[model samples]
Target chain A: MAWTAPMIDEVTCGMEVNMYFPAED
Target chain B: MTGAAPAAEAPPIDGSARPFLPRGVRLKFCEVRKSWFLLAPERALKLDQTGVAVLQAVDGERDFDAITAHLAAAFNAPHDRIAADAGRFLAALIARRMVETA
Candidate 1:
């Protein structure tokens, strides 16, 4: 085992989430 | 004009020397993920199966020859090829300060 540990979770605040849908031509 | 800076000295690694991870570098096996990772202060590196096999052989006791022999036997590959590849891999790590001679 040479590499480091795996990430468990992340916490963030005041962040915006955007969603996009596929548009037909 | 300023003179060019001298090149950093490369860590010594040869068939006769043993290589190990130094103080700043960390090695760990993740039980949940069943994977090995190497961590430095600035970055984390994922090791492939072959990389894991090679690093596991670097116990600071065995020389390159012994390590190569072990790997060749373990994988049923040609000894010379393993020797060359493992030597180069360890040497590169030594250059990066990830592996050190003992």
Candidate 2:
């Protein structure tokens, strides 16, 4: 497939929370 | 971190507009910093050091993978984490219309 710029698509809440859990704790 | 503040929504852009975001990446808004931010419509994200790099790399030419790799090498953080974080941020950005999916 051809290359494309990173467009804001899809939501990953698991990943998001995983990333910020430490900071919050 | 200096004069650079967050980007706010513009009428020129077609997308949702709001102040608070819905992404999972948590952030502490530094009121002292006085930053203005705009999430990509349909996208939600919080900018940390890596997120900032992702933003800088965004010339509408690179994908999330590219940004993740760049940040990985630049910060020496785990590749998996960077990719995951980038994915999450990208999701948020998409939701806000700050970026559009290809």
Q: B-chain TM-score, every candidate?
A: 0.78, 0.53
Q: Candidate 2: where is the Cα deviation over 4 Å?
A: A1-25, B1-36, B39-46
- By TM-score, who's the top model here? 1
Q: List CA RMSD, all candidates.
A: 13.6, 14.4
DockQ of 2: 0.04
lDDT to native, each model: 0.60, 0.45
In TM-score terms, candidate 1 sits at: 0.65
Error of 1 at B92 (Å): 1.5
Q: Give the clashing pairs for model 1.
A: A2-B37, A2-B38, A3-B37, A3-B38, A4-B37, A4-B38
Native interface contacts retained, candidate 2: 0.03
Calculate the i-RMS of every candidate, to one decimal place: 15.5, 12.4
Residue B81 alpha-carbon offset, candidate 1, angstroms: 0.7
The 10-residue segment of model 1 chain B with minimum total lDDT is: B1-10
